[model samples]
Target chain A: MGPIMDLTIFGFLVQDGLTTGAVYILLAVSLVMVFTVTRIVLVPQGEFVAFATLTLAGLERGDAPGLAWLLVAAGVLAFVMDLSAARRRGSRRGIAAAAVLFLAVPAVLAAVALYGIGASTPLAAKIAVTCAMVVALGPILYRVAFQPMAAASPLYLLIAAIALHFVLVGAGLYLFGPEGVRTSPLLDGSTEVLSMPVSVQTLLILAASLGLNLALFAFFGFTLQGKALRATAVNRRGAELVGVSADYAGQLTFALAAAIGALSGVLIGPVTTIYYDSGFLLGLKGFVGAIIGGLAAYPAAAVGALLVGLLEAFSSFWASAYKEVIVFTLIVPVLLWRSLAHVAVEEDHD
Target chain B: MNRRNKSACAAVLMGLSCLAAGSAQADITVGVIISATGPAASVGVTQQRTVPLLPKEIGGERVNYIVLDDASDTTTTVKQAKKLISDDKVDVLLGPSLTPNSLALIDQMAETGTPMISLAGSGAIVEPVDDKRRWVFKTPQSDGQMARAIIQHMTSQGIRSVGFISFNDAYGEGWAASFRSLAEQVGIKIVASERYQRTDTSVTGQTLKLISANPDAVFIAASGTPAVLPQATLVERGFRKPIYQTHGVANNDFLRVGGKNVEGTLLPGGPVLVAEQLPDSHPAKAPSLEFIRLYEALPNAGMRSTFAAYLWDASLILKAAVPEALKTAKPGAPAFRAALRDAIEGVKDVVATNGVYSMSASDHLGLDSRSRVMIRIENGGWRLVP
Candidate 1:
């Protein structure tokens, strides 16, 4: 074969890379957030993405997804747990708050979902409901799976997260079946850039990713709750000593991660077909991006994800069979660099 | 003796008589292993659903089937095959959906002296007439056969050059190899070749490179829904040339997932996909329609797929073979398995849902060009083309 390099091909590859990289950036950022705050790898972050896309797809067909029921069930369980804890503490006000937030909110949402089934639902309503349902799952998952084990070591937390990942995948398969689904594009049409056509959906993904990153920046830099999360991330015991509840910070971080993952799902749902098991591979790619950032810096992770995407795009052109290998091999050097640069700190065993 | 002792002795005698009667007519068990929950799950799910459609009785003996999930993994397929042979003692084996899984189970099938009628498309599963492959047969048309149809179509359309993107696996490699050799014979140039993982989310870069090569058409060798990714990207990036797919994506899931982007794409598939559109005199028409009728009548059958038709054809082969095999030997014996394999190979001019099967010692696939027809996707449905 002869060399067939050209500017148009290069430009298109870049455009495609960026479109895919946008999703990875969101995932990498979420992974960084959850890992920093909770010390868990959050392996099932991609399940939230699949659920979001499938829920929107169901809504598009004028059917309510089983996700609504899952949310309500989780909510009721959490509510009952909170209610009992409040009762034991003799705090009536805490019980009321728990009931309204967990029980009332999910019940109303489920009612809305039931009403929308078999009736043509507006696109915006569908999008909102999909996003909200996926976001709601994060805290509930955290409460049910991680709360009791919050004080455990990172290894235990990782095992729990991995187990949750498998369970969620099984549930996703049971709920969605084995077929892959593709939703209608949020934006349709294309524009010529440098003699190369770019899709409107691609542009939307880029815009949404950038906008979310900016909003996250403001949240982390200015808000009190954000500061509390940062404090907990920096020093969990220190934050607890200073009256910042580590448990609350962990829940908040999980919610933000889930929201980011779901938003990423909605953004990319039209561009690719997603099966129930698709998210695991997608999330692993993002985890690779997170690893590239040393698992700490958000901006570094974002840039690293973009690089991973671009590498994958170009490598496919050069050697498509080994493209995955090329993309994953990038982590080796980053790991080597990090290990050489930083000294290892030994942890005390209990 | 007391009256109670006399009654117990009578009951024991009756139980022994029942056991003897059961031994005279034993049930024939067919073991099946398909990729029910992995990358090839879409194809396997369809094939799995067709199990219930199989005949309850074959060769005047009751038939029992034991199905297991391979999850699209080769190791799992081998394990399942072992379990079926040693534990279930199945008389015949049915499936393992994808090419790799089917290829992986060949040795085990031979060792166990059992016949496996695979649902995969790889010709290697039954080619070369090796000891291992002699025990193996497949329902789907071989990649070599489908490649000939595609090359014929391309040459007829005056296409001289084509690009290729295949999965980075055995299935893709098999098709690419066949297409390359066949295209070369027909004087068609393969301008570019690329491969991607089945789990890959994007193929834009590969599509870009192929577009740059400027082939008259592009052949995507991937299977299932993942096959749509590269083709969809090609259209999105303004590659207006004709695109072709193999028989792998001949199902409703591909159409549903590809949506409008796949409209007008061409591929070669079994006659069953367009059974209603085939000429009345076509050899596969009657059996194809019969399968469609029976399959569609099942509750929650959804759309009929060529993969399922392969299983339906397997059932037909087994129906014809079991009676002959039973005449020679009893079930659960090595002689019975050998008899079954010989009977399947001796099947001649047997019309099936996919095509007329004429298995022989040297040729196990038994499918010819008559089994394949070119199809185009138009208006979200398959349209037959000359």
Candidate 2:
């Protein structure tokens, strides 16, 4: 508590928070991509990322075991298994069912590789596990959950996925036990040379991490046959009548979005630990980040995350503990204002 | 003649039988609560591997110690402590590690009246619990001691510029306050003091902020998950000032994570990470060297960690207290425990593999200002250069 308005603490905190915001921004944009397609809130997206970091850490540590090729083979096998199943189910039968399973594979592999195998393998095994899971996730989720949920209101499904994600994480912790989750840099002194202590480095890491996430979402939005997907989210019949293949658009959207989410998870290791139930926090933050960005604007969602992150950082300075509690509480007023603003604009239009 | 021979034979037989019984009764039972299957498992491995061996090295009559897994969960830890006391009926208790867990079970002291030694440095644990009792004793000095030592070193360096970073928790908060207060007390300025949550990945932003302040040194008070953040960020930014870390980083896990970045870390007792360079005559050498030798002989030990030494220390204290505990035991569970606690806490001149440990109702923490030997991590190993 330096002065009424001491910029010293505030300045540092804001910068710290902005970097945190970047992580949220990346996560939020990925979620928005999935929502845009199926309109179903997806919960497993964050878990995919959480598991990715674990796999990467394992690989870097040289304790993952098994040949790297084997993991790559596993990815190809899972992809084939998913596609063949879809092809068998009338090449169309249960998109949602298949998508759910695809999203789940990475988490399952991560749990097994971590607890069942322990730290026996090497870097290749871990990379294989991560690649196999990530490579398989996009193609499978697109074929399964997104394609099926596109025709229905997806709010319920999103809620169900969130619940399921927690259950899985809880079960993993129980099964694996929390004994071996602690991680260090995969390699030794070499990592030290890469880490920077200056504000510029901190800002860059955050921006890069956050920017990578936003770019993935942007890939889905303005590019990648956006016209075909938007038609289905709104003018479903007219878009189809013109030439949009609603089925493929739904598949591409979910696949693209889920891939980005999983990618973020892999990169998030140095940012924080990969806990069993880290997704719940990430999902909530990503959702809030999406809301902050007007729930649809990619850049806006990212900005919202940055602002929120800064706020969280400042609160930490005043009281080093309870940073999360203070920041989560602060979001209420901003959300309330935005909600009211939305209703007012709607009424004006009406 | 027959009467004389029979009497003599019976006496001889009786003497031999007594010797046999004495040899059989030589086994000792001490109890230790360690987190085997939880977040701290890496550190817990240290306790599991070292505590049981303390009895063997000291050549106690017979060493039988109970090692219970706390499962890294609090509720399970209390139940395990009760089990060790009631079921196993150990003579003395070593630890339930972590500050919070240690505080949780100190309540049992009222019921069991057992003499327990904890390995955590949480300052609040050592403070009077309403001044009625000092039953709870900690081996590591309170966070205040660590803070004071660091501030003194910084002052001696004549460096007024400092940067402080800590995780956001009770442990970190207490450590930060002590460090800052001591810094200010010594007429030193904390240029950029920043904190992060345990969940944060990088301390890059925080380090940069401190770098911007251009402090001559950085003091870190982080532990657990975010333990790697500051050093990693500091090294990454290539800002190679002298960094003083709290004893929170004594665990080798930080070195494993921090790697070559570990070279600059300054800690208690001068610098311990630079172990090889310590004078051959230094007291610290015997215990750590002996423990490492014993651990290396065992197949299941960790790559290398400070946990081994910490556990060895906790066990040696319990061994010093065991004999008096067994003196009046009735050879039953309840009576055996009662006798052991009474005997164990009365220990004096208990020189452990770590160092000489002496305790009283007034002072429980073993190490203080005089004990510190500052060292650093030099060329990928510990060399005492202080």
Candidate that would win on lDDT:
1
Cα lDDT for residue B270, candidate 1: 95
lDDT, candidate 1, B1-386, per-residue tens: 33234223323522322222235337887877777667667777777778777887887787766667777889878877887787668889999888888888888888879999999887778888897888999889988888899999999999999999999987788788888998999899999999988777788878878888889999998777889999998888778889999887888878989988999999999999999999998999999999999888877878788888988899999988889999999987889999999999998887987889999999998888789999999999999996
lDDT of 2 by residue, A1-350 (tens): 14123454455456567666777777777677666555666677666666566546655664552322223333355455667767877666555554444434544665665455545556545555665555555554444434445455455666656665665465545533342233443333322212322244444556567567656546546874865777665666677788887666666665566566655665455545565556567767777777776666777777777666776666554544555686577668867888887764221110
Q: Candidate 1 lDDT, tens digit per residue, A1-350? A: 96477887788789888988989999999999998888899899999898888888877877668788888988888887777766788877656766776788778777777675555656778888888888878888887789879888889999999999999988888778777788898878998866777888888999999999999999999999999999988888888999998767887888898899889889988988888888888888889899988788998999998988889889988888899888889999999998999896433233
Error of 1 at A18 (Å): 2.1
TM-score (all chains, Cα) for each model: 0.90, 0.75
* Model 1 stretches with alpha carbons more than 4 Å out: A80-93, A117-119, A192-196, A343-350, B1-41, B56-90, B96-101, B323-336
Q: What CAPRI grade goes to candidate 1?
A: medium
The Cα error of candidate 1 at residue A48, in Å, is 2.1
Choose the strongest candidate by DockQ.
Answer: 1
